[model samples]
Every structure is written in structure tokens, then in C-alpha cells.
Target: MIRSGVLQITLREESATTRIPARPDCLLGAGRQSNAIDRGDVDRTLRRWGASFRTSLVFAARRSLGHIGSQHIGYDDTERSLGMSRTYRVELGDVARARDALSAVRDLAAVAQARIESLATTHDPARSHPSTDTRVDAAMNAHDLIRATPALAREQGDERIVVAVVDTGVALGHPELRRKLLAGYDTVDLGLGKVGGMELVGDSRGADFTPRDDVGHGSHVAGVVAAQGFRLSPGMAGRSLCLPVRVLAAARPSGSRRTIGVGALSDIDCGIKVACDLGAKVINMSFGTSEAHIDAGAPPPHREVVDYAVARGVVLVAAMGNSGQAEKLFPAAIDPVIAVAAVDERFEVSSFSTRGKHVTLAAPGERILSLDRHGYRLSTGTSHAAPFVAGVAALLCARARRRGVELGTREVRDILVRSAQARPADGHRDDIGHGVLDADAALRTLDADLSASPHGRTHTHG
Candidate 1:
């Protein structure tokens, strides 16, 4: 018989003792009764009694605390900011007992709340990255193909590579995405939950490392890196792996340019740290400020951070900027990065893509189809060109890893430039870079190392 306001408890006679699941609602709280037992509480109780039940209760405290949709709790331990607190992991016996334990510690706030979500196996280091063959096509422009995949899988696109795109942010729900995605961070100066400024004061409670795209720029750049490569052309089917890292934000809803410049350096630094920590082999930076020496004749602090990441085996690919002048952009102008210029479908230099000595290569940037807010749209700028090289670098890393040869940023840079199919330019125009990206030719050179083996094939180009 079921009692009113109480849950229906059905007992199943099994081979062993009759163990009951925990029911937090069965216990009274604030001199009142809960409508039903909390499933998480019951699961926790059963597990305490050594029941063989598998479930996930791991959600970062900061992400779950303020959200009422989930039954989450937070723990307090002033001793460490990030490590787990023992006070939250005590045994509560049966379902009834678990409720009692929770009620007792609920007042403590931190003891019975949520936990941080762990990174998944797909994103873990041991887990191999996805395939890239589905991204490349034979008809891809020679330059587009070179910078569009990693050197490792230049021939077939089966290699695992990681390409980081630093921009406004991405729409995680994009159709062409979801699978190849690793979590990203928000560096937009949207102060705490306020309208503008950085979130200087971070989450007060637990660790929530979920990445979100504050603006659409990162998503767009990511699309260029790993969007369904089939979108590029028939020949460029599958060959790119995109990693989204947010380093900028839309200052206003209008999308018109506004200066929220103070945190740019900090945002970029944080992004570089996260990308490196996540083991991204290649980073695509598509944003920059033209005024190199912003004030007091000093360069931004992120310059050093970029150098550090590059020194640590990170290949930095950046946009030469769209200022349409010989003026150089920091980070991009840094020697460690492969600076890119933009080209159109007809292979002409974009009027806006920045040029100068820093330019390393160019790729199709004008009218490039990439992911955006609503869905996919055509965007123009040198920003789109950088990822082509970033993807190509990923292929190179894969090839190098297979050969048991580790590559530093400098070596990677040299290989890319040497492999490039130089565009017919009137010498390096401050805007067009060394030339447009040549994926087919670049792949051929990287594959030259493994020509003796059966893994890579030999092919000559025009």
C-alpha cells in the first residue's frame, strides 16, 4: 500500500539482503516533507551501502551552485582553492541515513553540494584525436589545402591533431561541430555577470571549467580550422581539427567596434595558458590591435606569453591584421607566429588584410564560408586565412610524431615556409604575405620524410 505524500516503495526479493535505495525526501527538512526522494541522494545512499550502481554526480560547484534546475551543493574549505574537500565525502549508510547526513551538513553549505566535473576521456591526453580526411578535397585551392590540415595526415587525413582558434567565442551547438570539440574558456571583459568589463572576481565556490563563446568570432575562426571541410570544396572533404579558445568579446550588441582594451593582454595570456595546458599543438590567433606600442611606448605583456608557448612546442598562427597598412600587429608580428594575409576566391589579396615583414603566408579569406550566430555565413578578413595554416601545422605535428621526431616552433615555421607554393607576388606586398597557402604541395614536402615507408605516397604538383 502506498501512503499519500510518500513515495511508493517496492521491495524486490533478490539473492541477497533486501537493500533499499536512499531517499532524502523521506526525511523531514525545516519541519516539512519533500514531495519525493532526490534521485542523486538515493544513488549516493545506495553507493554508501556498497551497492553496485554507476552514475555521475560530478559538476563543478561554480557551475551548479546558483542553478536551481539541478540538486547541487558546495563545500567550504578555506585551505585550498581547487582541491577536493574531505568534509563532503562522508558515508551516510541507508537512504534515510543519507538524508539525515545531508540535512546536518546542508547548513555548512559547502559540505553537501556539487563537485567539479572532470575532463572526459575524449578530451584526455591519452585519447587520440579524430580523423581529418573528411575535411580535405582534391579541388581545394593549392594554397587553401596546404594550411588546411596537419602535416601528419596530409595524404589521407587520418592523423590526430589539435588546432586552437582564439577569437570572440563559438556556438557549441553548430551542426558541423559538437564531436571534434574540446571545451573552451571566455576571456571577454564582460565583468562578472555585468554588462561590460572583465570578470575579475571569479566564481566564489567550486571549480567549473566549462568553456563558452562570449562572442561569435572564435566560432568563426574555429569553422575555418575544422568546419565540415566539405564546405570548402569537393576536393577538400575532411582534414581539419578545430580547437576553440575565446580571447575576445563583442563590446556591444551592435557588433560595431568599441574599445574594451584594458583586458586584451590578460585575456590573451589566460587563453595561451589554457591552450597549452590542454595540449593544443597549433594555435590560430585571428584578432589584434594595430597600435603595437599602445601607450608609454610599451608592448603588451602577452607578447612574452606567446613566445613562451611557442618555445614550449606550440605553433602559433596569427592573422597579419586587416588594417590594410604596413603596420604590424603584436603577437602576429612576433617571430614565433606564422602571420597570414587574406585572398579571395579569384586569388586576389583582400584590401583589408594587413601586410608587412611579419607576413608568412596567405590563404582564401574573402567570402570564406564559416560558422556564425544563426548558422553559417560568408566572412571576409585575414582572420579566416590563419586557420588554414594552423590546420596544416596540425598535420605536420602528426607526421612528426609518427617519425618520432619532436618539432619546435622554429622548425615547424621553417618547414611550413619551405613547403609553401609561393604566390606570384610583386615581392612581399605588406598585405599578401609570402604567398597563398598550398595544401597539396605542403603535404608533398612533409610526406617526403616517410617516402621510404608505405604510410605516405609520392605525388608531384604543378
Candidate 2:
């Protein structure tokens, strides 16, 4: 079985920096695209490297969260192809440990852009894997966001919309989430036996894999997004279909004593594409890579995928990191996607919630209750905060469908922003964008848009 610890290389036709014929990897970086930035020779070169690294999912972000977009939300991209002489695992169980290769391939256009394909863990220890004791329901009832809108209070059904939980994995047996989950793909096992996006943007698209959640983070995040209200009891949200895509894999090499949860931005990119292809209207990302950590101008692995989703009419929402500092996070920091921060019942931003221009708005990330394997429980983090926005976005989609009007990502984002209860702060209200997410306000905004139409087309509910 081809495994991890592989060295991925990239070369260019004309580079003043490199010496040709580096390591004798056959024909590497033979030609360049007309754009020059996008190379075709490298695409073929990657295919020859080995089954495309599964390119599916390498696992990195989140202590449990996913990037580091279910990026276990912070998949660390860049530096994946920096060093060339590393080991290259071939598909037929062949290993090519190339060394002393700098002189073999002179056409190395750019060497700095390439690095190891393996994802390095990027979890913030100060605020990851938050688990609070069984909190009282009264704690939830006091949340102003609970009363801020009709998220839970809205008596209705909007099960047609699909929300992809691009996180670790989701509990399939959970009573509340079991029925709502759509068939999701796991990038860990997905393969690129055939050529796909990997040739273009270096993404692994075609493959077969299973979506399974080992850590409870992805499941909890799903619950907040759309955990289906149960008959025996009720829960926070679940008005949309929950599509679970497992992108995070074990920390150790495959077939070892699996111990850690890892995620890759590439995996997140693949998951986002899978969700989009499967028709997910809203992609909920509960993990992120802090901008404070990455080098300037470094390409964000999930940025293209996130933008693609939005262009396809998918609303992307991600947790601003838990650093409580002004910085950018993957998917969330991408601008088009909604960046959610955390706030408490008093509407006070959580101490650990990230604050900066990237934040779209605040949600109840502190000790919020949602579905788990054992029933409802409380969990904290911006990881928990993002799904709430996703759920409300789903609600708006459902409402749009009823009104016979279509809602795009921007429309959804604008509705949320305009309907939000504004607060006072420095520079556009500091971290919390607009204000706390109010489900009812969003609903009202949707209705207002529908009513103001020139045609004044009207529709009704069941």
C-alpha cells in the first residue's frame, strides 16, 4: 500500500535559480503553461510521482476540529513540495527515495513553492477539544442568540437543503443525525487512479472512500448545523441534510497504531469539491489555519475550493480560530465565506474566539449544547460556532425555495449581515461582524427581499 512520508516535487522550464537534470525522476517539469504560473508538465509529473498521494486527504488541522474546512478546519498548505530529495511512494508499493538530486533536473523553475505533502499539525492547545460537564438547559435558555432568532423556535421543516459538514467525521448512529446524513465521501481512502483535478490545481477528485468520525468534533459541529430534532426529545438545529465528509486521517503512517487525528488543506479542498458535486448548498467549516502562522503570499489550499463552492451557490461558513487574536483563518479568512466568532448569552464575545476583520459575525460558541453519541451535551470553540451560521443559512435557503426566489451565497451573506443587530466597537464593530446571528432577523430579511420584487411573486408555507 502506498503510504505517507513522501516527497512531492515541482519544476519549471526556465528558472534562473535551478540547475537542470536534478534527480532523474524521469521527465519532470518539462514544459510550462501559457500562463506560466499554471504548469502542465508538473501535472503529468505529479501523476508519475505515484497514485497522486491519494491527494485525497493527508489530515492536519484541529486538535479535534478538522482544518486545519473539515479542514479538520486548518489544513496547512504550502511547503508541501519544498524539499525534493525526500521519499516518493509509488502506487505499486514501490518506494523511490531519491537523494543528491539538485543537479539531475536543471529545469526547476521554482523550488521554494514545493514542500512535503504531509500535513503538519496546527491545533491551538490553549482552546482545543473543549468539553464541559453536563450543563443545565437553563444555561441554553438564557442565550440571547437562542432568543435572537427562530433557529430553534421556528416550527417547520426544511429538510430539502443539504449542508455539508466538511469536518472529521460524524456519528452515523446518533438518533438525531442518523436520518439526516447524506452519503458522504472520506478523502483518506479516496484515490486518483484516474486523472482529475490533481492535474489542474493539484487536487485529488475521483476516488472511493468512506466518511467516518473517530473524534467527536466533526459530529458535534454537524449537530449545530443540522442534527435533526428527535422524537424522544428536541435539540438545537437540524432543518437541513447533514453531509459528512471525513478528510482528517491518523497522525501516524497508514497501517500503524493509529493514535492522532490529522487533516490537510488539500483534503479539505477535495471534500469541498465532493460536497459541491453532491449539491450541498451550505458548507460548514469549524476549523481554520491562523494567518499569524503562515508565510506571506503562501497559497491557501482551500481558498480555490471555497471560492468554487460559493460560485456554485454554496454558502461557506468557518470558525475563526480560537486564538482570540486578530488574524486570518482558512476558508473563514477567504472573504467570500462567512467567518463566525463566538459569543455568550449576554452577547459577549468569547474570550478565546478570534477577533479581527475576517470575522463575519458572532454565534453562541461558548458551552453550546448539540448532538453527541451519548445524547445531547455541551462543547465549546469557534468549531461549534460556525455550524450555527450554517444552519441559519440553510433555513434561509428553505425559505427562498418556498418563496420561489433563488438565493445565492452573497444574498445569504448580505441577509445575515443586514439583519444582524449592530453593536458598537472600533473599526466596523471590531471582531464581531454586524452582530450576533439572529435567525428570525435573517428570515425577515429574506421575506423582505421576496416582497420587494418587481413582480411581487408570492408563495406560502405548509
Candidate 3:
């Protein structure tokens, strides 16, 4: 993950530094680009601009090249790489020089960013193949566990659970999520742009960005977690509130032809931080880098950040990924994260959902109902399966809070796993994790906890 907080590049120091005063534009759009950042290209970029000119903004300098384009430069973020990176609009003694520097900085920075992004995708396996099949909604195990319709409706549906969808931006005005959105943040934009600007920046298509569902991925996942009004059948009708965080904007059409991979590690890390910072108890992550083999030591870089979030008492759920093999996806693959694998209506694992030792839970990923700008659509993917767990996690959180229990990630996991209906393949299979999540079973577990407590005081665990 990119870590939390903003990385501001200032042109001037406090006292003697000349301020170029310009808004920093995200060349890659509103979120992290899933593509790889080419190391060879970055090397070539630095070499092309040989001879160290006045790079420090704390001191005065002149604009060397006014081709008026920006360059994307990556520093080691270490002692050696510090203060060497050049940015746009330093106090080149005047505005023209500042403008030229700013332009140059933007241009070159774009090039460098492209290179770095290429490297970013190299480590992941999810982006290896391109697909045109839209996401489908899978059935929930609620039917088998609930038994009765009215009771299920009364006990399960009305419980308002807040799920934070940390991915590309959500369509805030979408009828399903608009009502339930308790709070939201752009994280990448710092909430600076106007309502329309939000979409424009998030779409990553320049000034003409629209918040509509360009790619149905985020909306599909969000709808599963907390769509406002839904009807799976006769008695299945309910909705949950969704908090949309636009981490990945639209990709540049020419740059990425197939999929738009914007949500970067930094964007994801920042999104999680924002969700935690906003007091969101449940976080849903449908996207991941690559899948690792089982028995691997610790998790990758992105997984570590997720662990930190889980430590803070937030329930994090992620997609097992769509590789159709026994591999572990980051964030989902992490021990703390509830990795969700997708199963179809037949109760068979989806061909796209990855399987491995880290698979902790399973959900219906085929023909699942969700909302999009076009209307309700049947979607499929482990991505959709994750939000189902997130919704269940929120319900659990609500029950815990109602009973006055200070729950952490571990305690939450314990309750959920214990409540689940043990399956035949749970103990050893690399496919389904435990089994498909049972909402009614989870609720019953909370009921048991509340009954055991003294005067409604729940227990705590680390």
C-alpha cells in the first residue's frame, strides 16, 4: 500500500524558498494505476536529463528546459534519494520560469509514472489476462439458515451496516448507495474538487470525467455490500449503506487498452486509513495485486498495511481473486484479512476465484444482483463475494455494539467462523474457505454471546 497521508512536493521552503503555487495534478488519474512502472524506462528518463541542475527548491534556480512538460521522477524515499527529486513550478525568479518548470515537471513526471506503473503490475497475476465478461451476483446461504422469510426479513435485512468500499470511486448518486452513504472521502483528492470535478478527476479521462459506471467493477461490489433497494426473490429485499472511496480514476484510454487499473498501493493504503479514520468498522476490498503460493512466510507489502488496519478493530474483507487456481492474493491472502472465495449457485467454486490456504470464507459469486448506472445487473467474481462478508461483518459489528462489546478483528473472526455451518471441505480444501458465510448463523452466534454475557456486557480479545 502507498501508506497514509499526503506526499506534498513544495517548490519553496518557509523562508527563502520561492513558491510556485499550483495545484498538483494526478497524471495517472484519481487512483493507483495497476500497470507496472517500467524500471528500464525510468533509467532512460533520468539519463536523458543528465547533468544535475539546481534540483532543490529550498534554493533559487533557473528553468533548464521549457518544452514545458512534466517528468515523473521516483525517489528511493531514503536518505540518499531525498531532496534530489525535481518537481514543477519552483521559484525560477518569475512566473514564466515557474510555468515552464511546472509544465516540464508534469510532462516528465507522466513519463516516469508510466515506467513505475509498469513495474507495479509486474508483481501481480490478476492483471495478466483481459476479460470482457461482466460481474454476476451469487446467491447467499441465507436461505438455508434463515428458514423463515418474515423472521429473516425482520432479523437480517433492516440492520443498518456501514461498509466502506475502498476501490475506484463509487457512483454516489446511484439510487442504491446514495441513501445509505453515511460518510465518504476521495482520499486522493483531499476533497478539494466540486461535485462534478470529483467525477472528472476520478474518471482519469481529463476534464470530461463522469461519475457514471464506466467499469461496473466498483459498483458491482458496492451494491452487494449495501444496495438501497434489492429483491432477490419473494422475501429477499433489503439494502445497506455504502461509503465510496475513489482511489482509481478512469485510466488514460491510449495508455491502457483493456482494463483500467488505477487503485495503487498508496491509494489502497490511504483508502483504508481514511475508512479507519472515518470510524468505519467494516472495510471491503475487491481488488488485489497478485496471488502467492501457500506456506509462504509473511504477506507482501500491501498485506502488511491491511494487517495494521485489522489491528485497529476494523473487519477487513477481500476477494481471493480471479486466477482460477490455488494461489493467495495480497490483502486477502494476509492472515488477518478474511479472504473470500467465490462460489456459484451450484455451490461449486467459481472458475475465476483463486483458492489457497488463506481462503477463510466462501460466498456466491455467480449471477449476484447489484446496481449500476444502467440499472440492476447480475454480476460474477470473488470481488462481489467479499462485500457479502463485509455486509455480514457489519451486521456482526452492529450486534456487538448493541450488546456493548469492544470487538477487535480477532474476536470478530472467531465469532464468524464459530457461527458458520462447518462444511466437508473446510479443514483441508484449498478452494472454499470454511464454507459460504451464513448470515443467520452469524447472528445466532452474536445472540449466544449476548446471552452468555452478564447484564449484556460482551467479552473482548486481541
Candidate 4:
């Protein structure tokens, strides 16, 4: 029987002779053929290798894909044409056994790929603490730098425009964020029993509807996007709604005072797909893994779901990482996603912000004021910088909808890049991409485009 560790396996499409059974216990029962293995063979193989069937990784998506068209902010013909592949999860006793099983699974003709689920963490730097001074003026100055005030004056954003914060999870009861958050999902699945030496999930056991934040990173990121300005602190998109999808959980390593946000790639992929299916117009991913951490020749993680989200007309924003190096990071480095780097109040790129060709824009991420579980606090990282762009993307989508136009992922990215204000001395550099994010300029460009286009026609950039 399956005991501890988890591994994800993707089966070949052509080998399938039967559909994946609805029962969670059923393991790779895709059918029997000259080349393909049946359910009995799958069970015997796993049992022989000291592993067992856990669950289907793409089962939820398969069930929900057909129903996504009925959701609010429905997809167009392009989105409906995309298809999902069959992937499954299995449990093993130890890391060595898990690795062996992965190798064995790869030999099977039906298996396309197999991997030990990798973990991703939030972009917050080590030992980063929140500033005690939580004043409104400091937050407003950062917002003003990006001309968010003027952009909000033009369009305060729409409740219909949802920006999914796919991070740890948000504080559901935070006064500043309660009204702005929509129902979210949690995809953290740490098998039936904990894997030895990899107890990353602090309190989270498995998937659930309640996405409460045990760690504060997700709450802070969510606040940047849609926190309601209380007494002094102002939210970037006050009218926009934040959908909190919990993929990362709190994990405090040995001798560390702070809990780092950690999550498996399987959960993250599921979270992204869920957010897209749930009608999120924009998704802010504030976590990443540096290129150094990835093994050579490994497939880029989250490629499928990122493509799925983009095809469905959802604008994606991701942190450029805080490694202080010119390294590539997944999801962010992947094309179609708008990668954002950290900039300080002076519009200088943060020392910690990773520089790469994929970076699309810069946002205030140094000592920036945002929300925490306890109350408002100031933190710094590309994690916070990403949400600022996400908040702005939500506003752009709202403005487009108000003008009776639909903005796709490419259109939104084009507007953000075109209207970005270049730094005077540095010009467009690798660290900051086009330049610092200018909310007012982007909205104004969108307005001009809609004005130039015929009424009721969708305007897209070449």
C-alpha cells in the first residue's frame, strides 16, 4: 500500500484505450494493448516497487473543462479548442523508492513522463522582516510613483474582473481584504502519510475549500492587488476582487525563525488551472525557483497550465525572483507571462531583483507597505512587486470591458510594455524590461486604442 512520498506521472495519449475511472483508488486503467499496460499490471508494478496509486493529478480539470464555458467571463473559440492531458499521482515509502519508481514508470510504454514532485517557494528574501511603521503615506508614495491614483480615478477597477493570487493563501478575515476576496481553493496534497525529511506542509494536509493563510506571504501579496484602503493605507485596485488560490503552505526550516512558503509543482499547476477555470481575468504568481536550482535538461515546470491560462484569455503576472542574479525562473521566464522585477521608490531596480531578458516591467518591491496576517506591515521582494502589475492588469481588463472590448493576454501585455515609462538614465535595461510600470500611461493607451477602434470591435496589438 502507498505510504508516504508522492510522484506525478504523465501517460501518453495514444496508449489510452479506456478513460481514467472516476474512483480515486483506480490507478492508470487507461486500457490494454500490445504496448499499453492494464489496471492489473499497473497495480502489480507499483506493488512490486513498493508504491501504490494515489490520485489523478488532472482529474479535477478533466471533470471541469467541459463546464468552464458556463462560468462568468466565458472563453472564446480559441480557449475551447485547447485540450488537457492525463496525469496521475502515486505514493511511495521513501525518496529512494520514489526515485526508483519514477525510473520504472518511465520505462512503461504508456508513460510519457514521470517526476518526483518539486517544490517552489515564495520570492521573499531570507530573514526579511516587516517594517514596524505602517503608515498610509509611505504606501501612497509607492502607488503614486506608478501613477495608480490617476489610473484609479479613470477606472477604480470592476468587481467582475478577478485577479487570482496563486500563493500561500490570504487572510480571509482581514478587514482590509475580506470584501475584496472571492472563494478560493487549496491544492496542497501531502499523501496519506508525511514523507520523511520533507515535511514542508506545516498544518496543511490535503486539498480543501478553506484557503486560510497559515503563513503571511499570500496575504501580503493579495493586499497589494485588492486590499481596501482602511484608515491610512490604500489598496492598489480597491474595486478589483482577489481570488486566493492556496498552493504554498508554511514551512519553517531548522534554526529559522520565519516560515518559508513551500508548495509542490503538482499543486501549483492544479491551482493555476482552477483559477483560470473559475473566471480569473488575471493571475498573479508571486513565487518562483531560480535556474540554478533546476537540473540540466529538465522540462520547464508549469508549462502546460501556464499555456492553458494564456489560451483562455487570462493575463498572467509573475515575480522575476529575488536571487540578485541574471538567472531564468520558470513561469516568469516562460513566454506569454508578463514577468515583473522589483524597483524601489526612486525607480531604481532593487539589488535583490533577478535580471533576465524575460522581465517585462518593474514595480515597487523594496520596503513596500502591504497587508500581513496581524495587520498592515511593510515587506520587500519581487513577490510584492508582481501583485502591483496584477492589480494594474485587473484595472486594464475592467476598462476594456467598460468600453465593450475584450482584452486578451497578449493585448494586456502589449499595453503594459508600450506605455511603460523608461528610466531616464538607464533607459530600457535587462533588469527592468521596458521600464517601471506606469498605470496611468497603460490605461490611457487602452483608452486611446478603444477610441480608435470601431464600436463593439475587439482591439488587439500586432
lDDT of each: 0.48, 0.55, 0.50, 0.72
Model 4 scores a TM of 0.86
CA shift of 244, model 2, Å: 0.8
Report the alpha-carbon TM-score of model 2 versus the true structure: 0.69
| TM-score preference between candidates 3 and 4, better one | 4
Which residue window of length 10 is worst by lDDT in model 3?
Answer: 113-122
Q: Which structure among the candidates has the greatest TM-score?
A: 4
**Each model's backbone clash number:** 48, 44, 48, 0
Say what the RMSD of model 3 is. 11.5
**Candidate 1 lDDT tens digits, 101-139:** 333323332222321111000000111111223333322
Pairwise lDDT winner, candidates 2 and 4: 4
lDDT of 3 by residue, 217-243 (tens): 667667766665444332221344566
What candidate 2 gets wrong by more than 4 Å, as runs, is 1-132, 142-144, 148-157, 189-208, 230-238, 250-261, 295-297, 425-427, 454-462
- From the highest TM-score down, the ranking of the candidates is 4, 2, 3, 1
Work out the TM-score per prediction: 0.59, 0.69, 0.63, 0.86
Runs in model 4 deviating more than 4 A are: 1-4, 17-53, 62-85, 137-140, 191-202, 295-298, 423-428, 454-462
lDDT of 2 by residue, 1-462 (tens): 112333333333242112121111111122111111223443344444432321112222212122112222222222122222211212212134221121222234453343333342224224334344545552354235544335456534377788888876777788777678888877643233311111111122323355666556777777767655452223233457788887754333344332233454445555676677677888887766555444343355465466556556777888887777777677688867788887777788888877777677888777666765456666677787787788778877877877675566677777888777655454245578778887777777777778787243322211
